[model samples]
Target: IDGFGGLRSKTKVITGVSLPASIESIKARLPVWNFDGSSTGQAPGEDSEVILKPQAVFRDPFRGGSNVLVMADCYTPGGEAIPTNTRAGAAALFAQKPEEESASGPRRPSHRAPRRSST
Candidate 1:
């Protein structure tokens, strides 16, 4: 969210990168990129700059094979996580329930309890 709490997002494609690397490696190779926040309603029009910090990586289910989907949080230039950085909250939530965490992070159980049949 921006100073106004409006949700915003953008799609960025990165190419010319080597493949078959671990997600952590990809994250390490990534850099903090910036964008015009005003264009995304994330900052004032005059000095609107929002910083993106990569936090996690997932296999790009859409494109398939060695592709990735990077998860990131927004932050100010000075390093303060913006309200849009909801992963911080999720981390805290998982901290309180470690067993709830899975390889893909916290998720609801896939199993369902059996219902009793009415006679």
Candidate 2:
């Protein structure tokens, strides 16, 4: 997956204090790319075509306690340098929140068990 073996700056940890809108924005920017091989996403198509396709985002212990982890799949043009791509992409999309909302927090699952009828 993307950011599998990248640097600390690459992967990010969204604690249980992040906002839903922020999460959505980050999710929407999935499949992040580091074409210039830099932590800050910039200068596209300069060096390598490393892409990070976010597979899923869930609440887990990525940094410490229950937090949000942006899992992704790295890809390259030759399909032979997945590790490289992963590392690059990871450095690009770390802990980047949405532009508008500044509030933060985690969201609990909405699913609930069915109730049984009384006899």
Which candidate number has the best TM-score? 1
lDDT for each candidate structure: 0.72, 0.49
Give candidate 2's TM-score.
0.32
Candidate 2 lDDT over residue span 1-119, tens digit each? 22334343355443445445455565674446433334333213454566556656765565544356775555565544454444445444443643544232233345678998897
Model 2 C-alpha lDDT versus the unseen true structure: 0.49
- Backbone steric clashes in candidate 1, count: 0
lDDT of 1 by residue, 73-102 (tens): 877788776566777677667688887644
Worst 10 residues of 2 by lDDT: 35-44
Against the true structure, what is every candidate's RMSD? 4.5, 13.1
Question: Which regions of candidate 2 deviate over 4 angstroms?
Answer: 1-9, 12-17, 21-26, 29-31, 35-47, 62-67, 77-119
Clash pairs (backbone) in predicted model 1:
none
Alpha-carbon error at 77 in model 2, in Å? Answer: 6.1
- The Cα error of candidate 1 at residue 27, in Å, is 1.0
